[model samples]
Structures are given as C-alpha cells and as structure tokens.
Target: MAEQLRLVVPLHGEQVSNMQQLVSVMLVDDEIMALNNLKNLIDWEEAGYTIVASETNPRNALESFHKYRPQIVLVDIMMPVMNGLELSREIFALNIPVRILILTSYKDFLYAKEAVEIGISNYLVKHEINEESLILELGKLKYEIQNTETNDRYLRQRLIRHLIGGLLPPENLEIGIKNKYLDFKIGSLAFLFAKIDTSYPILKEISVVAKSHSNFIWDIFNLANDTEYMDAIRLNPDEAVFVIYFKEEELKETVREIASKTCKKMQERFQQDYEHTISIVPIIVDNKNQNIRNIYSIAENSFNYSVYMGKNIIIDYESIPTAVNSSFKEVSVILNELESDFVKRDSESLKNRLNIIFTLLGKPPWNPEDVQNTCDRLVFTLVKFRNKNSIQDNPSKIEISNLFNLNSIRKWFESEFISSVENAVTIDALRYSRIVRKILVILHHEYNVDLSIEEIADRIHLSAVYIRKRFKNEIGITILGYLTKIRMEKAIELLSTGEYKVFEVAELVGYSSSQYFSKVFKKYSGLRPLDYTSGV
Candidate 1:
C-alpha cells in the first residue's frame, strides 16, 4: 500500500476538562506495525493531546508535517529516503516551534549526541519505550506549550482591555502592532457582542458558559483569519465581545456580511451542541472617527434592544434609532386608564390596556431603564388595587429586575399580577352578599350529594327565586350553572387520582347517570371521561 496519513480531531460536544487544552501531535515511523504500536501506546485525548496525523513514510511525514504544522512530532531514527535526524533538521530550519522525539533501537551515544545537536526533544530506545516514559516526555512539552500560550493570552487580553478603555497610549499601540500582538491594519472595524438568551440547568455558572462560548468563537474567527484579524474577549459572566479588523477600508459591506455569517455559525453550533440560544449585536465603527471606547459603548447599548427584537437574533447598531423619547406624560395617562379598568373588574379591557402599554414601551427611542420604571409603576397600581379590595392572595414573587425583555415582563404581568387582581375582584363582588355566600358554601360542601336551588334556599331561610337571582347577580352565573362548575371540578380531581371509574366518579360528584356525566365532561373539558382518563 502507498504511504498513508490520517488526521483526527475532537468530536463535537465531547466533555473536556477546563484545564486540558488539547495539544496537536504527529507520528512518523517507517514500519506500519511500529506506527500502530505508538498510536496505541496511550490514550492521546485523555493525556491532553490529540494525534492529528500519522505517516508510515518519512518523506510523506515531512509533507504532512508542513501541511498540518503539529506542535509535537514523534519520529523513528531509521527511515527510508531520509533519516529521522535529517527530517528533524529540516523541521528546525523552518523556524517553527515544534518538539521532536526520536525512537530507535540504537543506544549509541554519538547518535544521541547528533540527535541533540539537531534540537530533538527526546531520544527513546525502541526496546525501552513504554507508556510511562513516553507520557513523561510529552507532559514536559505540554507544560511548556501551555505556559507560553497562557502568557500570550494574558498579554493579548490586557492590551485589548486597555484599547477598549481608551487607556492604551499611541506608542504602546504601535509597539503592540509591531510585535504582531494586535495585527490591526488601516481599515474598517466592527464590534460583535454575544450574550446567552437563557440560563440552562446543565451550565450552572454563567462565567463557565461564557468562557466556553469565547473559546468557541475564537476558534471560528481564527479559522477565518485570512480575510480579517478577530480578537475575542469575555466581557462578563454572560457576554463576550469580538473586535474585527479589516485590511481594506472599501470592505465595509464585506465586514457586515462576514460578521453576520460568523455570528450565525456561532448561534447554530451552540444551539445544536449545547442547547443554548445566544443573541448577537454587530456594530460597525464610524470610519471618520474610530474611537474604540465609543464603539464598544455603542455595541453594549445596541444589545439592550434584544428585549424587543427577541433572543437568537442579530441586531445591527445602525438600525437602532438614537432619538430620545422620554415622555412620561403619555405613560401616566395609560396607567390611569389601566387603574380604571382594574377597579371596574373588566378583565378583557385591563388586558388590552396593559398590552397597549407594552407596545408603546417596546418601541424605539425609549431607555430600558425608563421602560422598567414604567412597569414597576403598573405593578404598584395593581398591588394597591388588590389591597383596597382586601384580597388576601399574595402577589407573585417574580423580581422585576430579573425579567430581561418586554415579552417576559408582559407574561409576568398577565400570569402573576393581573390574574391575581381579577380573582380578588371576583371575591370582592361575592363577599358582600350573604345569600350568595351561603349558596356557595352549600354548593362546595354538598357537591357530592344531590343539590337543588330550593333545597339550598330552605337551609338558608330564603325564597328559591330570590336566592337564584342574587347568586346569579353576584357570581355572574346561575345557581345551577355554579353547582355544575363545582361538580365538574370535583369530578376532575377524583378522576386524576385514577382510583375511581367513570360510573363511580359520577356518583361521587353528584351525577347519578354516567352517560349524563360523560356528556357534561365533554362539554366542559372538550374530552370524554374515558379519553381524559387515558391521557392521565
């Protein structure tokens, strides 16, 4: 068979420890059996390294080495066409930082000396080679590589922070550019900010998820480094920002397209692999005056629009309107209408009025803080309405600050605040009428037994006609209608226990006929008793 080379990489969603950044490795041996032995010597991935490629021919190994640029290379001393020492010399002459290990059966000191002269990292006699010795050598090399990477990363992050804070002097920036740390050119630039849309149970800490997100984005942009230089940094526990530097000023539209595609890819991969939804905002820096601090500020401000535009979306900075519309007078008028609707106990009108408020606040030119304050005021009004009516149900414990967007806020108001207020209003209407109260008590207590308006009126010492009219007027339902509601609710509770059959539940909830109960259950719950039980 011809010389073979194979490449491998980490599979997607593989769990890797935070301390283990994978180091790439290549193996070159003339003997196919020796190559197989070396590959099986250790679990490369478990040891914090990956066997990216293996070649059986020295010449082919050299070509693959140049193509892959692996950080570490393991080669046999005896090879056809070119010896391992000659290949090491060629690799060293290329001026790349690569560690080379020599494997051979010869224990001659002169060969070892020659290998050392060629800058080989270690020389292992094939007879003495085992997993322990090989791992010891690879461990040292991995430590050195990690130290170098850590230092470079710290320096790069410091420089980026200084640049964004407007603290980097011109001279220092020039030095950074010269050292290839910045790699910026005279051209257009953009800032892309990404934030997680929801907190997942698996990722407990925001900082851990943010760091992973940053690393993932860095890998993607680094792959596209041929067209632009991208620098990514984690801004906080929940957000990461990227600075994109273009080589040509005329590539303005290209910058937008590239940024959009990069963000789209990040969104897709994170969602697919981790079940996360991230929102990204890309802000193109003003070419006439490229102030790093101002550009970053604009990018952050633009991210707030995710509340209205929604999660897993891309919002361009230019698309946001800058005009300030801080008029609270209109908001006060709407609040007054909302209070009126609440006091009148008109649930539909109250919901419509609340929706109108969200619509007006959700529009552009309004500060998010102002919108939050307006929502707080609406909550306060509802709370006051509940207290005035003496409704004892506590307001929902949802924190307004934790609600990130207008949609979530609207849901909180409807499910937590408005629903409680409507229930309180219904109770207030029923509390003043003794006849209605007595009728309700009888219906709730005697729901299992056969009940009638005349029977309830006789127990309460009132006329059947007066009791029916009063209960209907106070509760907005006829006496028979209310009894049926209570009986149906009790039937559902009993059926949910799975301890009673349809005929048995009919007797337990005041329905003498199972067929009549089934007909009534279908009308109330849109399912026959048997169908509902099957689902349960």
Candidate 2:
C-alpha cells in the first residue's frame, strides 16, 4: 500500500464563516490512520485554526505546505525517505513563517534534539501526549502566528501611509528593508499604479481565471524577495497601487519578464470575462541614490501618462515622455484658450487643444517635474477663472499635481471644467446656458427657413453629439423635435391672423411645401389648416 496519500479531512455539515478568522494547519505522518486521528487532536475553530491539509508522505506534505502556506504543521519524526527533521528544514527554508511541531517516540529523543536543532518549534512524544498538551502547544503556535501576522500588517500599514503622505525620509524606509520585513530594499522599490473599477462579484469571476486582486498586490510587494510572494490590500473602491522592488540592472531581464507576464496574464483574464477597462502604469523610482520623497514625486508625475493610455495595459514609465515645465510662449496661449473654451462650454475644442498642448509639454527633452509644473500653471488659471465665473461646475481645487495618473487628470478636468469655470465668465456663457439659449434663439429667428441641428451645432463650435446630449439633458427633447414644435406654433399664429394663404404661411414657417405643412399641422393640431383658420 502507498504511504503517501494527499488529503484534507472533510468536516461534514460544518459551515465556516466567509471571513473566517482561523489559522490553517497541515499534518504529515507515515500512517494514514494516524493522520486522520490527528485531525481531532485540537478544537480547530475554537483554537482559531483549522486543518487545511493532511498527507501521509513527507513529500506530499512539503508540496501541500508550499501550496497552502498553512500557518502551522504537525508531523511525525519517524518516516521513510524524508524524516520529520528534513521536512521541517525544507518548510522553514521557504521563509513563509509557519510553525512546525514534530511527533516522535521517547526512544527517538536524540532524533528529537536533532529536530529541535533544525528549527522545529517543538517535538511531541507520541506515547506520552494527550489532547491537553497538544491543545496547549497548538494554542501557543496560534498565538505566535497571530502576533507575527499582526505586527507585519501593522508595519506595512505604517509604511504605506508614510509613503502616501510623503512623511518618511529615505532612511526611515530603509528600516523595513534592513529587517527584511518588506520584499525589497528601500532604494530599489518601484510603483505600479492601477485604476480598477470592479464589483466583488465580477472580481470573483475574474479571480477564478486569474489571481485575485489581493494575491496580485502582495506578489509585487515581495517581488524583491521572491516571485511567489502573495498578498493584497484594497486602497479604496477605485484605485490601488502595488509595489515591486528591483535592482536597476535586473530591470532588463528578470524584472521585466516578471512584471510584464504578471500584467499580461491578469489583463488576458479580464478581457475573457469582463468588458470594462483596467489601467496599470509602472514607474521605476531609480532610488539607488535618490531620496524617497523625490521618487514619490517623479513616479507620480510619470504615471499621469496613463490617463491617455487605455485600460488592461502594462505601461513602462521609461517609454513615455517626461514632462518639463518651460516658460515657452505656448503656455500662455493654451491658458488663454482654456479660459475661453471652459466658459464657452466648448468641450470638443477644449479637449483637442488640451491634448495638443499636453503633448507639446510632454515631448522629449522635457523634465517630468517641469511638465507637471506647467500643468499646475494651467490649473491655476482655471482656478482663477472658476473664482470669477458662474458655477458651471466648481470642482474644488483638487491638487491636480497630486493626481497620479493621466486618466485621473483628464477625468477630473472634464467633469469639473465647464461647471467650475470662473464666476466672471457669467452664467450666460456656460454650456448649460449657451447651448440651450443658442439653440432656441436659432430656431426662433430661423423657424421660417430650413435649419438643421447639425447647422446649429456648427454655429456654436460644438459637435452634434455634444449638442444633442446637452440639448436632451437640459431642454428634455431632441433638437429636431423642439424645432418642429416651434415651427408648428408659428404656423398656428400666422393662420390665426388670417392674413396669409396656407401655402404662404407654410413657407413662412419653414415648410418647403404647403402640403407637407398642412399634413403635419393637422396631425399635431387635430384639425386641417382651414378648420384652424375658422378659429374652431
């Protein structure tokens, strides 16, 4: 009979909490029956732990340990091929922080001592042990796992906050690196900023195809230590930034393959199950001799390029143009354009000109800092405009420089621009006011002639799509329909005066033929033109 049997003893009819706060355990022994008996050795849930894996073969036990990363292991010392000591050493070599206890015979005291030397947490005498002692040791192991995980999480939380707040010096960041608590050294960390808009349910489906959001995040955190490091933390509902630490020389070979492959696999899975977009922008901080604060600043400026880059992509910061601020004559021109476009509610022109100007600033030979400063300079103009203009959309002064990605920057600008224009622009100049009023004015004066919605859009320096959306949103009807209603009302007024013939009245109210005009008038007015002319 084979000694190695891979299994997890099923606890039938037992329901576990979805967010169970339980430490997981694995057991290994030569006897299958002994493995089964060990399952009942501790009240797993009560001790805040559960038996996740049980295998008779030491080889199978090692495999399961790596796969599940169980927090605790209980193994028998006397086994063929790989004894308990060899197995414990192999487990500890992974450096994943698991507690391993050996089950040995009293006659095997020498072997037990050797096992202890190999870093086994403790050894249990097979003949002497009872549930009480087993439970006591298990409780201690559970405490150790709890304390370690808690401390690691606390350290990580503090580090992340400090980095985000830009509060820590490079020396402070090096503390975690020196202690091997973080996956990478302080000087070699890179940031991968991503914008993900997904529901938990959708993520669950995607998770089945690819790594879960949590696992992918943690993988990068420990990429400096090993490729297999897995962890995840959600920053908020929309955005998350993952860190990958790497040496500058490793960027071409080892790091690029790992980073690109991870991103591509996740992106392919998302494309398979979901239709929405995802954004990933990777920026190497070049921290070997740079300050931590400078890394954060530069990385942020570089990531802003991703706004132009679509979702489900892996973008390298080095490949994109770094923005530099120059006091070129073009800066003032762009600002002047933004001031007029924002007030005129001319989104199409505004966006086009912005894309051109932003590209100009982002071209080669530009420092990323100066480019961001240029953008900051432009935003300041918008802020000044907002203060004087009607509240078309006063998106509060978000430190645009503080925004990390291109998509974020463009989204913020588009959403808050027309509405947040300066008070001095006055309400009448805004899109809401201008688009609606302009359309009405055009139709009122031109109702007696041929006028198309496209023509109205052209006259206002806006697209038909923009006009239609704003028209329907504000006036509650399609442009053509509104034009028809105005034409009909004018026709009725002309007929009531009883001065012009029906054909003449039709031409006067924008009808090419009096016949089509009469047909439309009767349908809308519930009577022929003559009946209406009779004043009935």
Indicate which candidate wins on TM-score: 1
How does candidate 2 score on lDDT? 0.61
Pick out the ten consecutive residues of candidate 1 with the lowest summed lDDT.
1-10
Native-to-model Cα distance after best TM-score fit, residue 257 in candidate 2, in Å: 14
Q: TM-score per candidate, in order?
A: 0.48, 0.44
What local distance difference test score does each model get? 0.70, 0.61
Candidate 2 regions with alpha-carbon error over 4 angstroms: 1-20, 40-47, 107-112, 127-133, 154-298, 303-328, 331-536
lDDT of 2 by residue, 433-461 (tens): 76677886676556667887788889999
Instruction: Give me the displacement of residue 325 in model 2, in angstroms.
Output: 8.5
